[model samples]
Target: MSRSLQTLRRLALPAALAAALLAGLQAARATEAPVSLAAVALGEADYQRVNDALVQHHVVPRYQVMAAAMAALDAAAGRYCAAPGAGTLAALRAADEAAVDAWMGVQHLHFGPVELFMRSYRLYFWPQGRGRIAQATGELLAAADPASLEEQHFRNASTAIQGLPALEVLLYGEGAEETPSAFRCALLTRIACNMKAMAADIVEEWQGGKIDFARTVAEPGPDNPYFESAEEATLAFFQSLYNGLELISDARLKPVAGASIEKAKPALAESRAPGRSLRNVVVNLEALQGLYEGEGGPGLGDLAVRSGADPKLEPLLRKAFRLTVETAKGIEPPLAEAVVDPKRRKAVDKLLTQLVAIKQILRSRFSPATGLPIGFNAMDGD
Candidate 1:
């Protein structure tokens, strides 16, 4: 045979073998049974318990903390703007860090009142959108009159300049601390005040008598517009849990870690300006664990156990969560730095693997135990 023909035969044989292997894998996946948790039955009382525990232990407390933190941040910004001193600026930065930390803790609760007014996006716009935050914030600082930095003006301002991300740029970006212009100081106070207002609004909506979302979850009825039944409410909670994991895995970690070191995109890490990317992940996992274990209240695990879920499933899942958090905590600060380093990158990759394992357990075991429908899209935009 000709040399070219010989080379073609050699390549074709391996290509055919690879195609057969892929076909076999696809067939194996196709034959697998659909996951089902229908065996786990829950009554109205059980639903009420789960809902009440979640609100009492998870939702209300976290929002309250965030509101307090934002209020402190607003006060610090006001003081710093008024004084423009070294001590005050340092205090403002501290307050900013505290508020952001509080936000990371509650960020996983991506439903209810926070979604109504676009508060979540307003509170923290991520991915930076190729420096939209910097542009909008700079413009606001340059053009905004000190007197015009009111609540209404901030409400009407570009969403990019209304939240924590913009504040970070103003506080930590170039010449921000050393020689903050009067307009920049005013803008900082304005953003902090706006964040406080948004956080307060979320707490009010959740606790308000006019439309208490927590009550709606706990007491589902025909009158309620949001949840028609307890099961639907429970499913929504499960979706939140699942979506949190999805976000941590797909959005937060995957983008920074990438498929391999050569493809790593370290700059994509959330809250990179403040060097709290790993800290954010740690808090996020803790929040997910709280939802799973119910933080000493009736949570998904309790419901699963009560409804005949595998007894070992909850313990195993808890172990996985704890290990993931521990692993995350070990990673150094500024995930941007860690994402590019060989040693730290391996640690992050390991954590990602653990998160994926936890996700699988939730999909294959936890959901099946709780009667959470298989193939249900837990994420938004699905």
Candidate 2:
């Protein structure tokens, strides 16, 4: 054999080894942590009933309220297609609430078990948020002569509850006041990502034949099994979930709203310089708030199904739970580092800290099956 041929063979062996390593890495990334859907399976008929209840009890009431609001807002929409000029928006909001009440009444009238449905399965899917730019854009799109604003809004709202991003909104709940439109889109995007996390649970259950809805939710005890250890896939799933929560909390995940009160501090001397009028600042802030809190989105039913029952589902839920806990803990520091204004930063810092606490509490009180940590208790199961 020639000397060159020997060298080529040596190089080829390492190349093959490198290729093998790369393949392993990719395989790890694709292997998902298992998630069980046994609890979601009530039976086919029962599952259908739950879906029906979701639409009737949770979804319908939400839609009724939103539709009423949209009607009033659209009525008030002038040539500019902006909000109404008179008491229209206020009255409309009231009407929407009343309509929601009426819808709720109807649910009770027929199902009678509506409250149980709401408490048992609805809260998980409800999106209780609002924003300006996205709201305006949504309104604009809805009022665009050709489309139904209320319908579009309903869809956006549905996506929100599902934890999926809404129609145009991007991230869900973060960004500059001026860029409400862009922020809206960003907010929706993040919400969609969160839904993707839930989707993992759904697909797992579907595959297991446990989520028929007709049967009652099953609980998988200690005897369940596990799948191949795809740490990389689990990490990616966790990352997506964390991104969704971070977007909700830090608001950094959304689009950078149009230039307004961004984080940058003017030069120290500039700080001494006159800034935008105080009145304008106040107005802008109010407008921004209006955008954030005005709209509604999708909602979850009030069912607390266990994800860890089946051998396949436990790892995914556990992984997801762990990710959620980590996200709650990590929210404050980054925000503290980012904000330039001391007062604003301090306020946000406090708010984020509270949110972290709330999330921790929710995890502890609500998450009985996942067996992940709640703050210090998180170490309990591990």
Candidate 3:
């Protein structure tokens, strides 16, 4: 409830052999009660636990942290716009990175409160091209009054210029640290403020500002527009996990790394201007991993094991997730540079390979265990 940044701070198995290549550490999971395969089905009560742990512990907490981080960015923008100086610019850039990191943490989620106003895409639009960013940036700066950036106006503005992508255009790159243009400053502050607003709205709605979207997700009913059954609600999180991973592999990893190292396209990398492209996918993997494990409670993998799947599937997923994160972190240079550099390019390739391996493992084990049908994404890359 407090505006203070400190107050709101509440914060996969792979193929098997290949996953062990990175972060060679093993994770231990607590033992869960056994349920026979005959009873593998999730009843209304079981679904409630799944929803409660995911919504209350996983989704809401992450959204609150994102709001706090965006709030910090807004404050930093205000401070710098008030007086442009090298020190202030440097502080602002740091805040920008922090905000991007927070967004990355929750970016994979695309349902519930985040869907209220299409806030997710507005907060962080990616796969965006440089020309579009350039044009959007130019148009905003060209405005005599910069009126389009007004809170009410940004809502109607093209999403291209609305959030992180546009913010990167104005806040980063050469000479970005040195500034005097009044229009550029105004644009930066507005984007930051709008992002802050979106983040707050998401957190509030999830916590019941407009509607307890989290509870709506948790308790599905015949009359409920969101979900008809608790199992359906449970599947939404599953879909997010799969879809989020696919987005990373397809959108984030595929475009930059390209099919072969020889055809790399660094320009397409997300958040690359701030050197957060690698960090972006890394955070995404970590968050998706959290979703796989149920955030803090009985993750799907744990539930699968209890539901009569191989008990080893849970740890296998854990190992796969660790390896993927370790592999991504292991990349020496950021994506843009690595995609172009010959020697380092293989590291990126290996990361892509590891990511696919994680997905394959999920398809084979996690899906069957949880009893959730394999969706289109789960069937992808097959």
Candidate 4:
């Protein structure tokens, strides 16, 4: 008989049953680890449910939010360029921040529709080499014609000026306190519209436009191009978690903060000039939290708990992710400067330490529970 059925039979016995027998049965059951009766089968339906929930609830909505924010940014840029003023510039800056925050929430998701046509990079090409964004922005402005940055023409332009970093170069530096010349404003608006279109394209593709990457992810099969089974689809979701944290630790944080006190390279800090480098990582963690918990339904943690009956799995995951996010929250901003500040730098280092601990749990426990491997991410060109 199934374990669940067997347990039910034990419970259904008449109250007149011997007290000794009941005590023995209860003691025997206490020795076994608890399992989710629903997860015992580890079947197709469970995987399908997880895949559907993550795509619909966690992934698609974030991309949609990004698209909406970019649209607002485009409109704000248009308004500011039409009539430059303190108020309009302020509006433009607000919309820019909103667009960036929304982007960070979904930036870690590099696969699916976001990979199509390199939309992610076109949205915010990072590590653009400190002054590169300014150089690209200056060139576009020098052209003094919006056509140079319009969709068709700018599609092939340098990735640097094609996205958010370029917007920062125009809006965050020395002269940013004042409105730009009419021509510079025109280029800014053009870049904003192009980014707006890129965000919209990603959302539409995931939501069932021509690409329909979401469908590929949700409905894996032997004949399906992207994923052959639900397990493979699950790995992709796990990779997003693994890769997101890895990116923050290695690519985003360490390169800027360096190995030790004497080695810090503050200028290498990303999003430095804009003073939001740390905020981006925090929002990324928030998005990852949503992925782990599931936005409104069953999530990866449920799948992991069901997979191996690892009693410590869920609580460990919850604590690890929570502590990492909290650590990141504790760190102050102007990440560029903070990394070099002797007193403030420890908070940044502490966040790095937390990232390592969380990653260890992911590699040693959670990934195996979900059937993914340690270091399974594609960053090594494997």
Would you estimate the TM-scores of all the predictions? 0.87, 0.27, 0.86, 0.85
For candidate 2, the 10 contiguous residues with the lowest summed lDDT are 268-277
| Candidate 4 per-residue lDDT over residues 1-382, each given as its tens digit | 7543343333223232234334543453364325433334567777788888999999888889988999999999999888888899889989999999998899778788778777788888876565877887776677777567566888878888788988888888656777678777767888898888888888888888777888888778989988998878877888888778888888778988987768888877777766788988899888888888889987788877777545656765776577678778887778887788888888787777667656655665566456565564544776
Distance from true position, residue 329, model 1, in Å?
A: 0.7
Model 1: per-residue Cα lDDT over 221-292, one tens digit each? 898888888877877788878778878888889988888888889878887777778888888889888898
Candidates ranked by TM-score: 1, 3, 4, 2
Query: Candidates 2 and 3: which is better by TM-score?
Result: 3
Q: Indicate the worst ten consecutive residues by lDDT in candidate 3.
A: 3-12
Model 4 clash pairs are none
Off by over 4 Å in 1: 1-39, 146-148, 374-382
Model 3: residues >4 Å from true position, as ranges? 1-39, 173-175, 376-382
Candidate 2: C-alpha lDDT = 0.30
Better of 3 and 4 by lDDT: 4
Each model's lDDT: 0.77, 0.30, 0.74, 0.77
Clashes of each: 1, 61, 6, 0
- Greater TM-score among 3 and 4 belongs to 3
After best superposition, candidate 1 residue 358: deviation in angstroms?
1.1
Give the clashing residue pairs of candidate 3, or none: 12-317, 13-316, 13-317, 14-320, 293-299, 294-299
Superior candidate under lDDT, 1 versus 2: 1
- What candidate 4 gets wrong by more than 4 Å, as runs, is 1-41, 145-147, 375-379
RMSD of each: 8.9, 19.5, 8.5, 10.3
